[model samples]
Target: MKILHTSDWHLGRIFNQQSLLDDQAYILQEIIQQAVNHQVSAVIVAGDIYDRALPPADAVALLDRTLNTLIGEHNIPVIMISGNHDGAQRLGFGSSLLKHSGLHLFTSFDQLLEPVILSEAEGSDLVIWGIPYCDPEHVNQYYKVKTTDHQSAQEHVTQLLHEHIARHYPHSATHVVISHSFIAGASVSDSERSLSIGGAECVSADLFKDFHYTALGHLHQAQHRSYSHVRYSGSPLKYSFSEVNHNKGVSIVSFHADQSCNIEHVPLEPKRNVRIIEGELADLLAQGKKDPNNHDYVQVKLTNKEALLDPMASLREVYPNILDLVKVRNNEGSTNSERSRAQLARSEMDIINDFYHAMNNEHLTDEQRQILQNVLTELNNTDTERSSKRA
Candidate 1:
């Protein structure tokens, strides 16, 4: 069976405060097209289907239409779950009705022990275990124990999952575990929230020892874990500047009765290209390489002494995605004394160097000279104290 693994679509996400509904619609259409072309049996959306629990009206409409296009038009089954950013009760609303339309949403841990089984006439079977984002309060209630950290929560859930698999599949059938959490060794993007601090929420890699394959989400970078069978499908689009260099895409996974799977990455087309360009304003204006024709989001760094007049307005005339601009101040100390003083104070060596520069190069008042001497004396005393302690 072929399954498309995609997550963190983050529908209704905004880029620099601009709505990404149009970009999301375009990517969603392409995803359906890929599903049809590849003849995939199922599409598994791991988590964070919406940017927020309460998505915007347009986001709601867009998701509704996209789901219809995939299931009704293409006749593919979809399995989705809610993440930390999603409200389980809200996403689970009308889920019973949507199931009749071939959409399976596992939004809460209340049904964590349940497995959604799909089988075909060829004697091949798939026992998919869907574990949604667990709220500590909910998991503690279900397990009858107070799970304080993510590690404990994961332990509780994994134990329950193993029991469920053993009870239902008899330890002989092929199974896949789908979950949304931060697994160890996975790269995190700025778009996602940290679920744990100091390894509190992290689970061991050996937790999925019984499963044929593990499909994960939460981290926006698609990658394989220590086990080849465990993988993350990552986010479908670049939601933040931290992910500007990542290739946004989906993974098409094919499963066989032999318990082997093949994974393929299908790229998504961006509505507007994201590019970072750095140079002096005069050079950028003269080069005229910031194509005005295409709608591309751009970050331009002005590597000049000062910023030009209305730099954004001028750049927007040539590049639509000039969402951010930064003026790179030259290294030469500013003529302004306050600016120089603040910069010099940032570094220990620079403080001493600035003092000496003032002493030898610039004329200074007796009061200013005495202040610099006092600062140097404090530094010398601190160094002497450290040396004495070491000795």
Candidate 2:
């Protein structure tokens, strides 16, 4: 049995205040195409199906269309769970009714023992257990078990699943665990929110050892943890500038009749990619003119020490989707803050003169300088008298 694993869709995500519905819609179409091309038995969406708990109308529409095409049109079964960003109750709305259409949503704790059985001519061959993003308090109240942190919560939850499986289906078969979590040792990028402060949120990869394949979410980078079968499919598109180099994709997992598994990564290309470009403003403009995909979202780093008129406005003329602009000075690549620190070392008069010129495009006249000096001397004398009185 073959299943395509993908997650972290983050529908309704806005990057730099621009909507990503078009980009998301484009990638989801490709994913559907891949599903058809690969002929996978089911599609597994680990979690983070929405960018926020309350999503916009268009985002909800996009999700509806995508699911309709996958489940209604193609007759593909989708196993989805809710992530930290999702409102579990909202996402799982109409889930029981939707299951008739082959959409299995596991959003609450009571559904942990339930399994989505992938059957063959003889009987069930694969048993999938989904553990959604849940709080320790909710788990404690549901199972009457105490869990202090995220790791402890996840450990206890998986332990119950193990016991339930052992008791009910002791037969030989391929068991799959689908969850949304931050597994220890998985590389993290800026886009993912820390589940907790310190290291309390991270769960050990050893917890999923008994399963044939563990499809995980939470991390926005496609990778495996501890073993090849345990994996994260990553977000379909780059959500932050830090993810410029991420090779975003989905994992196609195949489960054999013998209970063995094979995992393959199939890349998903976005309509417009996120990237960073560095150079002087003039050179970047020159380069942008020659580039065809200059429309890609970019963060510009200008190497010019000298000031320019509206660098962001200028860059937007060529690369219309510039994410942000940063100014760097000198051969050593000092930042804008470093330049300000250097200005801090200058005399007050010098700093004022520079600020005056920057604002008015003219330096202080000799008469203006003399007037400023007299005012400074008067202020110094007044400060001296006040300090004497205080002493």
Error of 2 at 106 (Å): 0.6
lDDT of each: 0.78, 0.88
Q: What is the clash tally of candidate 2?
A: 0
- Per residue, candidate 2 scores C-alpha lDDT tens digits across 1-391 of 7899999999999988878889999999999999999998899999999999999999999999998999999998999999999989999999878878899999998678888888877634789899989667777888898989888898899998888888888567779999999888899999887778889888989889889899999999999988888899999899999999899999999887677788999999889999899998778999999988999999998986544667788789899999888876564576768867886777768767866764575789999999999998899999999999999
Using all chains and alpha carbons, the TM-scores for the candidates as numbered come to: 0.82, 0.86
Query: Where does candidate 1 stray beyond 4 Å?
Result: 286-294, 330-391
Per TM-score, the best of the predicted structures is 2
The per-residue C-alpha lDDT of model 1 at residue 112 equals 70
lDDT of 1 by residue, 1-33 (tens): 788889888888987877888988988888888
